[model samples]
Target: MIKWIAAFLGYFLFRFPGAVLGFIVGSFLDNFGGSGNRTRTVFENVTRQSVSPADFELNLLSLCSIIIKADGQVNQRELDYVRQYFLSTYGKEKANAIFRTFNQVIKKREISAERICSFMVQRTRYEVRLQLLHFLFGIAQSDGQVSKAEAQKLKEIARYLRVGQHDFESIMAMFIKSADTAYKILEIEKTATDDEVKKAYRTMAKKYHPDRVVTENEAIRKGAEEKFKEVQKAYETIQKERGLS
Candidate 1:
């Protein structure tokens, strides 16, 4: 009853994620109704929507497959990277299940970027989606260089996911190295003063901090930490170049 109510209210107020969050909270409330004490639900974050592990894995693999196929021919390294990352993060059993689903469903059919982004926008948090973009960039760069086709596809995916231009550029900078890459990672302009650069670093540090991704799994939080480090590196690089160091 409570779950249904949350689903209704959440859908009306938010969207897919709202419903998921409602259900998770509802489960807690329902359980509380029966017993005085409450227990935690296994959906990634406590403050965010509860995306089932299985479902999240399936959809995530689907997205990876899309990226792998984006550049015409698939690279063994890219495929191995995805498999190895999942294996290390989720463990053998879960990774096996994820691959099974990938082969049976995701690998077989061509899932549209629109469909994936639509689900992500409605059901997931902005932070998670940002991490997703970062992961895709990793795939594009796995073959040593990100092809023009792969880069274009990544941009399309980011747009579909409703990622802001600055944020998109920020993630893109982490993979595509250039003279102004530092500024892009900080999501700032090149002409910004020292103070402004520091400010951007602080904002980005807080935004990409692993703590912000507590609702996600350990692997994903680790990924956030990696992103946070990139932001730190960018800031330091800028500081040195500008003689602030």
Candidate 2:
């Protein structure tokens, strides 16, 4: 039994660096943040303390790898984009942890597309799923335009995530609609006064307030939540620019 467990552990340790590393980083961050109890329930009810690092790495790589492949190439800019994003969102320590795991996962030669697809299909959170989609969209736009292959891959990923066609369209629309260079969110004109911003916020807040939108369709709820976040971020950006808040 000892030998058997040891062999199993070795196999996984060799196979799945990302999953194990993700679990470790996740667990460590959970502990560090001291809010594991209040975090997404997916981690809360997990039965096993020892998660396969490779599996976790594969999952993340699956998403990222697909995005890279979407453009039919993986350029330095895209790689830097992922690195910087992880650093900004998860901090250097956690990002390093994930990078270590991904490094191992990729070392396994000839990673199959089927396996990669399955990995993405299994892992990732519902809410985070949206964020991942957003990230993919961002990646697609890294070169100032998305390629046909990239577009199709994003759509395939969306389908795998069960994100409806309409939802996918809307998500893309949000990004595409902001064709301007202004940092302001909501895309309101630069000349807009304080009162105009206030009215826009009030209008959006009423429509997207979580409580108010709870009764709407799931797609609507999700869109509203994302939109609301955009609105809040935009409002904050404007305030900072005006030195009001």
Candidate 3:
């Protein structure tokens, strides 16, 4: 019922994540409906939908499922982490509803990580999925340490996401020396004078400037503000390196 509703609504009615939730919940209800057919029902409904393939929601859910099941047990703390993150990053109302729905659906089943990943691969893209991989790594590190299971899951996700081997290695690398954070970011160098810094700032200001961000969504605008700060930090760091105040 939940998966069907979410799938029907999200795919047919265009309700975004609501549909995804519907699918997950519906399957749970169907299998456990005082009978034992929810599994079959969930599988059928999943087979019915096709548009949500690979990139966005599908891959996200798949990766999350793997992470949660990595240690052979999913704890309340991890669940809380995911819930809080969704609430903060997405929205409170949606997060609350999703949590309730998922609890109602998956409280019984313990599906394998491989099953989730199989479904995920069917929906996500092969490239640029490292961003999602990095997100998982960040979440796993939220507790001040990463578990062995988390590390294994990260490697699997990295492979599935097709992140370059070098990029994967550098994901853990730090403090070699950027040499020219400014030049790397702005395509300018140390020899470039104050005027050059000003020019670089100008170009970067245009590139990372908050005003340039589309303001239709206030949330998106805030993200732009963060990006703007990074740009400012890089420019200032460069300027200070050259004693330019």
Candidate 4:
């Protein structure tokens, strides 16, 4: 059955890049079997829409490599975080393949951050773009702190993505724990009344909710879930500090 599906995909997607992508995707589907069915839905949607799965995956890998190398050297911790992410999202075989590809891209350093970001901005939905930014933050913090170089690179990526400063700051607050970070995460001013803070929290909670991401991709939804949790934690921190219930 899987062979038939792969053959069918290969036949239909016989074009150069699509043929190659179809073969890879078909193999992934074969490995996933029942558990991977959801990815097929996402694949179908991508085929019908703007970006192909291969392009999307490659763009992610390219941008991730840029983040990993932003601070002079790539740490094992950052590599491990990326490996774990791909493993949990795409299974072991695909994860290993992606890691290898990522290494090659990094070694070549041929893909520009601007080119990748521009492509993503044109093809990816806003929510997915935000999720990507969130993931970059995770990569930067893999070594326990986001360095100045990494933060600047992230800001550049966010600017290219047209993500609002508030939104970028909100995501940043999640990884950086500072006295003002909680307020930034909630997008509320410190001078706001307790009621105002509560309102901001609710607004941010609703905005960053996992369900609001509107994608069939479970991995993307899971990333949004992390953002959702960050919002909740930020709100709680604010309440505790301000002596509000």
Candidate 5:
């Protein structure tokens, strides 16, 4: 049993050093090397507590910085967009602190979007991942358009996060408006009838509804609300174009 636990810890320690360390140190006195049942319980508790809201925000901002630098130059529009998002979501005091920390982290090392996305996929909920994708699109389009480099980087991050093509395209459509973007945003075929479009819109809205997000964090809920609004706009655009409303 100890061998099994050690092996498990060893595997995760490389990938999640901080979490594994906390799990080990925090459980050392209480449950380390205890009965199998007690050890299992401690393991479950530690796993559940591994990723906190602060951790999520840091990873998100770090990845956002990576996207901002994808085009080889950080434009003022991208920086302004990030600052505004942080201020709105986290408030001025917290946002300023987080923004400073993120800038320092980015300057210290080159972050790998794949690594960040992989970590997020393992730690975050699906709804949170979708919201992160929405933010990524926002960053990509901050400078008026998503350059080829930025678009490809976003695709790579999406793939690493295990986001489906439909979801990726749906979020992309929200940022890059076009004749068929509304249909793509709703994940419906362009040839679909009015009823089919309506059905698709309803299903997507339900899936992305802000209330569907299970987090207690207001920032996360606010992000989800934005996504919900984007979904609503897509449906409205489609209906108006087809004269269905």
Candidate 6:
């Protein structure tokens, strides 16, 4: 939710600055940009009304709490990353409003991970779920490195989200670098032929293309673009190792 959602929200808000503030649960805070800006109404309604805010909070916010608790201790860096991300993307007023709602959700009841993941797998698109994992890894790794406990929790979440092993490993390689990370990110064997390597790079590039998630918010698209960049980096690493053109 932080990275993808933040990226997409920032991108769309830029294009339509007015529609961005409508996210507040009730009333425009501190007033609108100007009396002349006509897009103000659109800003409030163009996004997420189709998707229930309560439902969105219950799932994504719940996941954030679980990740913050994953490594046996809550890290303030992770907390700040989540907070600043929302504040920067949604603006102070909206972000504070979201935190209010989030706090309410935490206080009122518990939403099981099984049900949350089930809702995600059944309701959200595959590409979005992929970005969800991408964002989750970002959270886990925010404090510098993802601990073993955090990594295990991530794996469990991936399985619950029904992410394939190859896809899961590909995303994992982006955060947890290793000698063979390039190969894993590209989903290819190091023993593959030169042509196979080229083909894998092409496939990954296409698969992670930002356009593939066009329907996603600007933040999700940004997350997809980051994966696309990682794919490019992985290809470059292999190319340099093998001296491919």
Among these predicted structures, which one has the highest TM-score?
6
By summed lDDT, the worst window of 10 consecutive residues in model 3 runs over: 50-59
Residues 64-155, model 4: lDDT tens digits:
88899999898999888767655544568977876766777677645567767777666556765776687688789989999999999999
Better of 2 and 6 by TM-score: 6
Give stretches of model 1 more than 4 Å off.
Answer: 1-55, 89-110, 193-228
In the predicted model 5, the residue pairs found to clash are none
> Would you estimate the TM-scores of all the predictions?
0.65, 0.51, 0.45, 0.69, 0.63, 0.70
How well does candidate 1 score on lDDT at residue 227? 78
lDDT of each: 0.69, 0.54, 0.51, 0.69, 0.66, 0.67
Which of 3 and 6 is the better model by TM-score? 6
Better of 2 and 3 by TM-score: 2
- Candidate 1 C-alpha error for residue 151, in Å: 1.3
Weakest lDDT window of 10 consecutive positions for candidate 2:
37-46
How do the residues 141-241 of candidate 1 rate in per-residue lDDT, one tens digit apiece? 88898888888999999999999988888878877888899999999989999999989999999988877776633334555767788899999899899
Candidate 2, residues 124-187: lDDT per residue as tens digits?
Answer: 4444455557667776776677677877877887877767665566466545554331234444
lDDT tens readout by residue for model 3, 4-91: 5434543333222323333443444455452332223223334333422112233344456567667776666667655755554335
Estimate candidate 3's alpha-carbon lDDT, on a 0 to 1 scale: 0.51
Count of residue pairs whose backbone atoms collide, per candidate: 3, 11, 14, 0, 0, 8
- Model 6: per-residue Cα lDDT at residue 67: 80
Q: List clashing residue pairs in candidate 4.
A: none
lDDT for residue 239 in candidate 5, whole number 0-100: 76
